[model samples]
Target: MALASIPTKQYIEQREEGYWIKGSRVSLDSVVYSFLEGETPEVIAQNFPLLSLEQVYGAITFYLANREFVNTYLQNGEAEFGQLQKDCQQRSPQLYQLLMAGQARLSQAS
Candidate 1:
């Protein structure tokens, strides 16, 4: 018997660094985050208005199929993001302070 195959749809593409949706700048992590945040596929699509329902489902399916790998990738990506953010802060301490203050205000409002 032959192994099952995925359908030919331009939903997600895997790169050495990460997975992203095809024809859009949105990352697969963004979709997975929305799903994990208790959002349904429809809600995810709504939150990322640029994405369609089908694209969101495809990204979710890919993540579910490769949960462990995607999780590790996400963790590494977050680490890299933190490093870059730190670099940016060092480059512009005043901007970082302003951003932190704005975030604090937003948090208080919420």
Candidate 2:
């Protein structure tokens, strides 16, 4: 008898925004970050209800297998977001201050 093989599932898709779970709006970054923060696959699934346990595991496997690429992607995204934040602060100081206050309130509430 020969061992059976199955096709690998593709859990992430690259979009203009970033890598997301295929067929879902959830981002691979969300899953990877939670996993890095010591979350279990089950917990990650709970955090992103859009994803299943299998998808979470698959995403984690993909991240692990392409760690270098994913790390670079994450770093680039962080830099882009930081630049966007700076731009927003410069473009609309009042609006940025209001948003910061709201964020601070939310943090305090948490």
Candidate 3:
């Protein structure tokens, strides 16, 4: 089947990554990114309570169908995250301190 033949309502285009998938209302990129970050499907589902197992699978299908685009997105995200970390360290020392403190707390909790 053609790409256009895919049902629109069943999917949504991720704004940051610009990819489409079923369940337009859901943030598939966020889900996929969480998975890439070593999060389990159950954890992801907990984060997105409205998402079903089938919908999560559909997001994976969408990612597989557009591997290059998703890979680029992941690459760009790392670059952007690095830039943001640098900027935050330079431009917002107090915020950086607060973030570090939060991270420390999280680590201790874990």
Candidate 1 lDDT over 1-110, as tens digits, reads 99899778868897766788987889898999988888999989988989999999989998899899989989999999999889989999999999999999999999
TM-score of each: 0.82, 0.92, 0.69
Task: Return the lDDT, model 2, position 48.
Answer: 90
Give residue 44's lDDT in candidate 3 (0 to 100): 77
lDDT of 2 by residue, 15-59 (tens): 996899999999889999999999999988998998899999999
lDDT of predicted model 3: 0.74
Q: 1 or 3: which has the higher TM-score?
A: 1
Clashing pairs in 3: 10-22, 10-23, 11-21, 11-22, 11-23, 12-24
- Tell me the lDDT of candidate 1: 0.90
Residue 69 of model 3 has an lDDT of 76
By the lDDT metric, which is better: model 2 or model 3? 2
Question: CA lDDT of each candidate?
Answer: 0.90, 0.94, 0.74
Q: Which wins on lDDT, candidate 1 or candidate 2?
A: 2
lDDT of 3 by residue, 17-64 (tens): 555444456666687887788887777778788887666766777777
Worst 10-residue lDDT window for candidate 3 reads: 5-14
Ranking by lDDT: 2, 1, 3
